[model samples]
Target chain A: MTASDDFAWEPLDDVDDLEVGDRRELSLASGKLVLVMRTETGLHASCADCPHQDTPLAEGMLDGSVLTCPLHFWQWDVTTGEPLGVAELPLEIFELKQEDGRWWIGMRR
Target chain B: MIEVTVEDRAGGRTRFAARPGERLLHAGLAAGLGLPYECATGTCGSCRATVTEGDVGSLWADAPGRRVCRRPGEILMCQSAAAGGALSLKLPTAFRDRREPECRSLSGRLSSFRRFTAEIGTFSVELDEPVEHLPGQFALISAPGVEGPRAYSMTGNPSTEPRLDFLARLSGPGKLTPRLFSNALEGREVEVFGPLGRAALRPEDDRPFVAIAGGSGVAGMLSIVEAALARGHFDRHPSRLVFGLRSMEGSYLLDRLSEFVRLSGGLFRTTVAFSDEAPDPEFEAIFPDLEFTTGYVHDVVRSGLSSISADRPICFVAGPPPMVDATMRMLVVEGKVSPAEIRFDRFG
Candidate 1:
């Protein structure tokens, strides 16, 4: 197995803490940053910064699964980091897993 | 109901459902057919096409694209829909992507609004997110409680973040600004779509630069000046900015412009021309280094360019349709500058 795959699932936070249509900012133990969001379906995580402007994505407005940048209003698919129409940059997404009723995000490093 | 036949450049014929009240560009864009357009409203003239058959009606009959219309049947597709049935149309087969920067809708709170003149106001929007845009770009702002979107140029420097500056003119009777003039509350949420415009400042060779502006036309010029200062263009090539206004009160961007002059350090010079009123003494005192003139902006630019003809300069004009048209005529026909070298954008 690869080193990225070898790391065991480490609990980050309780799923009940973040409500639907809300986002919480947190720093990982590995020093990598992530934005955890609770959508209608469940939980999703991505890089804190917007790929286009380096502004924090948590600062944007959330409409369901879409997050719109407040700076220039560029939007992205929060779950997959896929850019919407007229959005030039794609977001950075991370894998999320649930273990023992807690949520955790998979980090490459 | 007018039956207009839409045809591709390859002479393929397809019937499109068009109405007399709708515009041709709207119908074409809504039909999912890729048509060439920028500023899909009437101003850019990118949607111009030749009418192969039938009678059509154009709302703006005297559109400037009529100049490029050689045959009698040519019409602006954006301004005209279909007046009668069985209409035929043709478009260019291949289109080049002008690839203007991408734009999206952003929400902002009005940080401040101040009147600079009786007909103009300078306002800033503090966005929760900082939108990225190239210099000399514009945004479509939808004021809260307003029905439609209004396009305004970004006067703020691209290097700055968190807030954007816009100068809006109170022309005739409009929806948003009139409400704003009556005192719109600060911190109110406003929707904006933007960073739209192609009037970029690119300096070639070492020829002097000529910039002409009237009223809020300074938006694009401000972006150009910022770009120039960032690239040290003034140090390498001299620049002359000619600004025109109806009266002394109409000149609102003077302070910001004065800072540009200070940065250029004798390499850049600004000329202020007043049309309806004589040059104000206070303006002269404040802008001691600037040249003052009494006349229309286009005429002032004509005289300035005429005197500096030996310099072989490239001219840029931005303003209302009349000002842009008048200045283009003076530059191309009177000043003898090649049409390819002169550039202008009508903000109307």
Candidate 2:
């Protein structure tokens, strides 16, 4: 409602206690899994599955701003969704914002 | 025999012939096409390909790697056999050229067996034909009473004597290792298919390096260290190894690693990180050159990378999957090292 009809922001009420270097997977209304994490920089959102394979990114390791898949050690920049290390594909990213200390993630409606 | 054709990401194709029940992955690799694989024994799922034409049959229906083969036509190339007259598959890799000394199948004899701990042991495979493999490669060992082949990294390189050394941790009774450690079975014939794994140490990789290992995972790191010592590479660079064990009771390769530290003239150093117990004073006296610390391997490396002399040192890591993951995160995230500088193979 804050933006246009093409984009809708959903309240992520479960991530109230997420700390730096912590990641959690959230189930969307469309049955898609979204990965939410807090890095040293800020909170970021991406598809919970690695783009190389469907390995859950919530089980992966987050170092600073980089996210690494535990399966094959393929890495990506959490903020830019750009491929790093052995990854050949970019991660699917979503816009995450905070208001009044709470978080809301924007998805294509 | 039927034609087995493999297509890569760039649409380049390579063809080889395989028999009805032969693994097309082995055929492609033996034919000198760099078919991608890690543990060639139905694990890691790196050799997965889509069957675009003809057909293939699964040799192992319950392979754990099958988790990756979700599509109807997708198959694990290492666990599948040719079933039809002509077969075609597509790989996700851009055609990786086969490096020198492509793998082949051969028979070897067990010799020079010895035990370090009650559950851990080592021996040499005296091959009928000498296999020249790079440091850090592994081979699959299949003995008569064992269910299937188990992969073990080469702890030492092939010498003029035509022997390859390996270490094995016991998996309990009725397992492959109980026999491997219980006897000195020289001239015991066994099947070996390898020179597999991509963590091989290359002279061109880096002068300064850091090797971290846990438990029996030190075998591969030991091979790399020996190679560096043999080729005089240890003389020029300041490299370090931090090996993790539960306690001094689980330690192995003390003589060799300690000697490497002593001979390197301060260029190479080793730290034994004990997770379960504090550094023992008795061991401190025995290994004067080695530094002992009380911490996990990842945590130990984070606190101190002793003798590491370069900002961009190549890193070699091994152990269980969880250990490798934790260490990799620390290296790339906190240490600011690029992933391109790290080399390792995934294993169960």
Candidate 3:
């Protein structure tokens, strides 16, 4: 199925390679970046840079769905990209889906 | 005069005046605006703002914080000054409602100085007026002829007396260190602005306190311990202090640590971690009360993480970037401590 025109599906990684409770950083050809997290429920993606001070969210501590930035301890929810704790801005969420046992990120179409 | 309008994410706006050649962060803080900032120096990208109108000039163009600015108009408020008549900037978040202590400019004279190690010196300044501050707050001090102010954490607890103490590691005969270490600096007047930084120990907190310091980073930890002791905090909550230094020859403040441990009656335990050497027999004899470990400070803390209760104990970490980063990572990733519980300041 074709995604909305606002997004284009871009291959990220194979579903088998990412274990549950794992996060990986991915960069797009357009220079857009996303941090992908695999949970028991599904795969979630958000902006790689933290909303607080631009710390790489890939380096953040992920406990369940909560992702904590390493720089100043700002946190965000990986599932919904909602700000948590001292974090004031929500992480920009990106659409992700699994196709043929491979994960793909939704980029701007 | 430059008119600065800072708009927070909540749609609230604060208008303040910025004097020429003054940092935007300093001007806003002096105007009583709760602008976000940590390490008013050119590090820790907490003070970043996006300029929607007018141009901004940076005193430290190559500030480390600049790397965090992902957009074209972003600037570090601590390093940027107004270069135009009017400027409008936007913050990514709302200003915190907590009232910040008033910031002001004060004059002080170097009252005392002593060499703690061959490269480290401890100094005291007697301000013209007493400045109130929390346990781990620091002051920005500019020497008579120094180009810019350097932030130094107060090594002693706040008191009614106008005297403040600091510990600094001399990088060499450089800008401010030479003047600070010089014998003639005693009685020389200097400019001090602050009582800045948010990592502090409050008197009402009951949780156990854990502090990790490296080299001169011990300055703020010393103040934290003093304040905690004054409030009888150690008597109720077990506290741990881990200090990392290169070797015994470069280590100072062991005597003070021993005295604090003795005063705590075994509640406050301290470990002096030597990265380069094991504790010598003579050194062990001299500091029988203090624990000696051989490793990086973060490694020492990691090894003993099981002993520390995870019931929301507040951790204060100060050191070089790598040490602070490693300790913070260990606490959050391995020890399962919340990031909110770890407090620290980063400098350029």
Candidate 4:
């Protein structure tokens, strides 16, 4: 709704309820699910399921900057998608931008 | 004898020989290959790998860990064995070569038993060979006629005694717990694979500690506390523990906890949290060292989390699935504790 908004930034819905240390799975138009978490550093988004066993990361616990899967307790830094101890795979993280008082999520540049 | 070949995603290949009836996971581990695993009793599915060449025999046909095998040839290494001749498998992760064997088979027999409550009891297993173990580790014990191994935390200090002791609670509907309470189980030979798990008590760390447990999960907590007390760790650092139970009738091991408190000279504190009922006056008079509270175990842990010293205390937790999950959430989210500092075997 604004001029010079030519970037393909997809508007994110249900972001108003995202609080610090909270995550929710969002259904994308592409039928892909992405888990969005708000930490002290701001908003972060990653693949909804864990790479190890495909457990839903939305059901996991996020402590500060790390997200721990409930099933096996595999941990990762949600902000950077870096695998933590006992985690063999890195998470695919999407970039989130809050611009013009609105939130958007897209592929990492 | 069977030949097993393993290939990992990191372009690493290794060949090893496995004795007949030996599990693939155990064989690899005993050979000093660092295969990633948790809850090695055909649970957690951390050792899922693909069979690219030959078929492997299934020990437990209905292992719950099979739920994680989605790919065409994926199988839980812990539950599979070399059926015959040669077998080739591939893992999705890299292998780290380690020096010490992660676990070894121990043929043990039921030596003694002591009842703590109607459903809870303590049993001792005398292994044919002595195996040194760290505190807070658990074993995967398979009894005769039991379809598969069940994980139990070792309650006895293995350093002092060669035999292993386990606290058993006969929760409704179990594969092996009912047999643990039977008098016929005495002298029964069983299979044990253990001294596994990483949440061990390191007395040298010299940091304050906290333990939260529910039901029979106190088995590991007791091991850690006893080990810490033996090394005089409590004299240098303060520690906290909370054990959860349904009511006074379900409670046991208070005498040992009381003894631990008395030996600590008040440095180590324990609180018993009852979910169903508060302790009566008569019960309260029995152990003056224990503090009794009425609430869920997770809340009890939360109430004391803020009071713990800020010098980075390692937290140990164990329980039924729901209690462990809820308590972990409380520690990481509400208590602001790091996930790295909290340790427990999922048994999931």
Best by lDDT: 3
The candidate maximizing TM-score is 3
Question: What's the lDDT of the predicted structure labeled candidate 2?
Answer: 0.82
Per-residue lDDT of candidate 4, residues A11-104 (tens digit):
7889878899889999877677999999998889999999877789888888889898887677899989999865778988887778788888
TM-score of each: 0.58, 0.88, 0.92, 0.87
Q: What is the lDDT of residue A1 in candidate 4?
A: 48
- lDDT (0 to 1) per candidate: 0.71, 0.82, 0.83, 0.82
For residues B1-348, write the lDDT of model 4, one tens digit per residue: 798999987778998889878889989887767876778877678789999998788997788878888879999999998888899999877785453325788898986788889988989888887777778888888888877777788986656455898888777446787877876688999988877777678545678888888888889889999988888888888898898999998789999999999999999999999999988989989999999999889999887777643556888888887898898878776776666688775544
**Model 1 interface RMSD, in angstroms?**
18.6
Could you tally the backbone clashes for each prediction?
Answer: 10, 0, 0, 0
- Considering summed lDDT, which 10 consecutive residues are worst modelled in model 4 chain B? B93-102
Q: Residue B174 of candidate 2: its Cα lDDT?
A: 33
Model 2 reproduced share of reference interface contacts: 0.43
lDDT of 1 by residue, A51-77 (tens): 543557787666678776543345678
Candidates ranked by TM-score:
3, 2, 4, 1
**Regions of model 1 farther than 4 Å from truth:** A1-109, B1-96, B203-207, B280-283, B306-310
List of clashing residue pairs for candidate 2: none
- In terms of lDDT, the poorest run of 10 residues in model 3 chain A is A11-20
Model 1 residue pairs with clashes: A70-B129, A71-B129, A71-B130, A71-B131, A72-B131, B2-B84, B3-B84, B3-B85, B3-B86, B5-B87
- Fnat of the models, one by one? 0.00, 0.43, 0.67, 0.33
Q: Report the C-alpha lDDT of model 1 over B288-316, residue by residue, as the tens digit.
A: 77778899888888776665567777677
